[model samples]
Target: MSLSYAYLLTQMVIFIPAIESWLRADPHEVLIVTTIEWYERIKASLETVDDPRVIVHAIEVKSKRPGLIAGIQRTTTDHVVLLDDDSIWSLATLQGLLCGLSAGPRVAGVSNIKVNIRMTLPALAPDAPSMFEAMGAGRHDRRAATNTAMAYFCDSQITCYTSETTAYRTEALQRPGFVEHVVEDYWKGKCKLSSGDDGAITRLYQNGRKTGIVVHDECAIEPKSKENTDYLKQILQWSRSEVRQLVRDPYLLLPSHRRH
Candidate 1:
């Protein structure tokens, strides 16, 4: 259908401003996918333009992966960009990410933050080095080399950034395996979901799949606030459950990866 392009947004109250940034920044034909509750609260904040380019979907599903992947699948777009509740981007950053995806087939992902090209570390631990650092656990301003495995590995680690604004190509990202990482359930009074999309993508790339990054300094991020304390507790509980299950059967989520 005209080689459509779209943007996916997970919402809460704070992200309304960021959504405005997205609506203005992404190319025409970009769709915004958000929870029904969130859409009800935030949709009105966006000014109505007669432009048929923006479409909104009311998401009933609570899990991040299913809902987001479903949104991507529903889109007629050839390219899809993903954003979280806390990320705000400049027009330049948005264009750069899209252009990076348009670069070539070998590039499966595009990162919006600064990236450190020369470092390696394990996947999934707080101690893991910042995927954007110049070196593992060290910061430097050096530019990264082009198309190296280590360069791709750095891209993989960045796949773990749950709250940061990022975008993806739909054809490459909609695989069933990638959607399996979303975990969701009611923790307290409110329905909640934990994001594991990036982590799963990181695992795929680390397993030798190809991906890429678009480093831009102007892209800024706002921290996500856990407004629902009970939801936070539930997330903690779910994480513990996942760890225990993984320990009992290493293949449950992470395989050949040590608990420590």
Candidate 2:
């Protein structure tokens, strides 16, 4: 019953709470994966962790999809958590995600509400309903259909639900040659043309069933850099193309992209 988990970080600073929460929430073994440059940061971030089940490794991926594929190959755990430095989750949220993993194989992945870290302020704080607006959850934090891309506001209630910090079953991700395909797309510029990690995961989920939000509240994420605005837009367009190609395959195809 060991849950194998991988967390990915780029140029962003790591928040200690996220790691602390992962250590506490990990039902089994946990591994922290990051770029070679962040090795020291990963060690410093784990100072408070008392769990022996946690291990940290350095990966050389310079971009999102490749990093994720490397992390997945490194993990032998039954479950995996792909996360970013900016994505934060609580212990309770992680617990809920683990509980849902027992539901069976068709469930490829799960998302939480991811809010814009920079957008948090008293004056502009989001109410419960508005927080999940982009993700298509009703006021009650209801579950929408899985396997589709949905947007939720980056608020205190639920963050973006982007795979930057998502939980998945290893078999589901390993199937359909998930990591291999992502890497191929990366080399092909599909990953770069799309936004980044989110687009890569969206493409992955299109090949499988991405469950609705199960974690309590949501995870917080920062907005992309102003300098990378064009990059994000290109990522969006590339994501559309990748989804179309991936979904057309007979073995791994999802029903269709349902707009939430």
Candidate 3:
């Protein structure tokens, strides 16, 4: 299938293994979009990639949500797969995502199950390098529950978004209405927010009565250690965003309005 892979780079330094993953996937294009401030740094790192299919662009906008909009607007393929630069994926995972997205026309996007793999460093032997170690596989590698965002039992309708490698139909994204919403969205039409990426993207697929499917073999392997306070903080941030949706749908909290 002809589709583009959109990678969002937020850091100044490039993740080498992530670049390798996209190259190995060998999709129609590996479009890496980074923040404008880190454009030069990321561009310099792009030199290592000699493939003609790789395209690196900078998001001029100052915010995260708009940055994603820039990538969607640049995509030329009928389908585009969104990826996190910090996460690495197997070729099989990409195949499954594409298959799930293309299964039906009304299916706007497919959310892949993100498995967080705890990262650990092996200590080298002091005596000598491991004698038994002959060869090693490089260019590789979630311990999280709630792998995908499934509907909950609230008024028989409780849907949320997935923050993983998701495949979305390009046609749905090109609409004028959705693009405008991504550009600038305010909470309660009063407070301006700089973030709310997952919720906005979820609407991208779920908009127009379209359905977002949670089907996959497995998505990206995010090698991160939750052994520190930083992990807890990140989880808290996500919880806050997820809860923001519940704020709008107050009936989710009411047993009278909710279904069994």
Q: Using lDDT, give the best candidate's number.
A: 3
Q: Write the per-residue lDDT of candidate 3 for residues 139-239, one digit (tens) a residue.
A: 11111222222333331122444544667788877877886776667788987665557666665454344444443435444432233455455555666
C-alpha displacement of 93 in model 3, angstroms? 1.5
- Report the alpha-carbon TM-score of model 3 versus the true structure: 0.73
Q: What TM-score does each of the candidates earn?
A: 0.57, 0.60, 0.73
Each model's backbone clash number = 0, 14, 5
lDDT-based ranking, best first? 3, 2, 1
Stretches of candidate 1 off by over 4 Å are 1-13, 47-51, 114-163, 175-194, 219-260
Q: Tens digit of lDDT per residue, candidate 2, span 1-260?
A: 23333444333334455555566654567666666887787677566666677677777755655656656777677778777553455546666666555565656666655443323445355532233232222211222222222323211112123554567777766776665556555434443332345545555564335454553444322222222345345445545654654454333322233322
Runs off by more than 4 Å, candidate 3:
1-14, 118-158, 213-220, 223-233, 250-260
Superposed Cα deviation of residue 69, candidate 2 (Å): 1.6
Lowest summed-lDDT stretch of 10 residues in model 2? 151-160
Can you list the residue pairs that collide in candidate 3? Answer: 115-142, 116-142, 116-143, 117-142, 155-258
The Cα local distance difference test for each model comes to 0.48, 0.51, 0.56
lDDT agreement of model 2 with the native: 0.51
User: Ten residues in a row with the worst lDDT in model 1?
Assistant: 134-143
- Cα lDDT for residue 255, model 2? 29
